[model samples]
Target: MKANDLNKWLVQERARLIDNYLNLIQKCLGGTIYEDPPLQALGSDKFDPVLREYGWDWPSMAHTMIGQKRLGNIRQLVESVLGNGIEGDFIETGVWRGGACILMRAILDAYHITDRCVWLADSFEGLPPPNEEMYPADAGDNFHTFNDLRISLETVQHNFQKYGLWDQQVRVLKGWFKDTLPNAPIDKLAILRLDGDMYESTWDALNALYNKVSIGGYVIVDDYHVVQGCKLAVQTFLAEKRLSPVLQEIDGVGVYWQVANGTSSS
Candidate 1:
């Protein structure tokens, strides 16, 4: 075979391997491995397509709960950055089980890209109580009461280890975004994904990290449409900064945009 053919074959083989690996990761994280059992029920049965697709239902043992849409979005965006030569690292503010970040690491490994890092920023104690006085948009928010949101840091680390993706390249900021993000050592970001589900969390993540995202980087608002406070915070931040990046929806509830220099919109 010619050198060009050998290179072509290698590229195809790499893509196949990465595709299969990512598919397995998606299945494992989405709990499709268990055939999507009913978490609340004592017995296993058929899965709910609608709930799983929209991430409305909880997973019994899955690593991620963002469902197929958001999970796939992370992979696509990460691959996009790598393909477009977008600079910097990847980060998620409210990584539930570290599944999304795991996928990011997996992609980097697949492409043999060693320069980028995967940053996981979460309190690991779940959402904080709504500071209603300061953030009226978060008034009456009960996300704090959701016991499932409080996955510990050790468990998250173990999750990354389980996938063989845990390494120095995966950095964990183990505190609330407001406290940790402001002083985060991350120099720049290519993908800044915000999964925090409240006004305060969203606002804090954006306030601390948005400016650090490279001009060509992406901003993924995980709960933009599903969580009103989250949406309000995003809009407020955009308005304040006069940013007008074109917004694109993912599965109705999630949305993202790529940063550009000095955009303005009313």
Candidate 2:
């Protein structure tokens, strides 16, 4: 489908599909555990709009904070890259249950984009605990200990297969972002998505891969509004690099910016 047309269709269908999927999952599983007990205590009514809008208040079927609105935002970004003929592969630096990454690959398949691949980067062990000595902004973070957030590489691959989207075009960079991103053989990126929740992980990803993003491409920060540490890391990194792209909001917690340098993707 044409990009404009697909965007329109997505605007109408994305929410319906997500609601149906969530309902199906709830029916199959009976119930899901709350990863954050504090939020559970508050119940959905008491949840903040920022949290409620992005599916954070929903029962955890997956660690995906992205819901229908954010997913539509991502689809638009990825589609813009393809529609504009940007030259680079698509990459998500902090895949959890691989839902977002799967969506990336699915778009490629739908658009018949054969040259560009989707790279799934993650520790497959949830997040890494904060390194307070080096990244002080993440001092009190304990997100790494949440076992519910950790999905194994095998399970992620299985999720991909379940959608019948598993193939060579899907690559996994399985390890902590700090350990895996720097030397990963990625040639270029048309869409570099950052979901790393802490200061260290978010900082490391931009430090290692931001330079490789094509000028017309996009860099999406998933935890930007939700995680203060992630926001700080992004602001600091962009300042140090003397790069200033307008940050655009996506639903509640997610935000993204297009690389605006004069450099060409060709």
- Scored by TM-score, the top model is 1
Residues forming the 10-long window of minimal summed lDDT in candidate 2: 29-38
* Candidate 1: tens digits of C-alpha lDDT, residues 41-83: 3243457766777777777778887888888998998988899
Q: Show how many residue pairs clash in every candidate, following the order shown.
A: 0, 0
Clashing pairs in 1: none
Tell me the tens digit of each residue's lDDT in model 2 across 141-172.
Answer: 98888776778999989878877789999998
Report every candidate's CA lDDT: 0.88, 0.76
Q: After superposition, how far is residue 12 of candidate 2 from its true place, in Å?
A: 16
**Residue runs of model 1 more than 4 Å from their true location after superposition:** 41-46, 264-266
For candidate 1, the per-residue lDDT at 47 reads 76
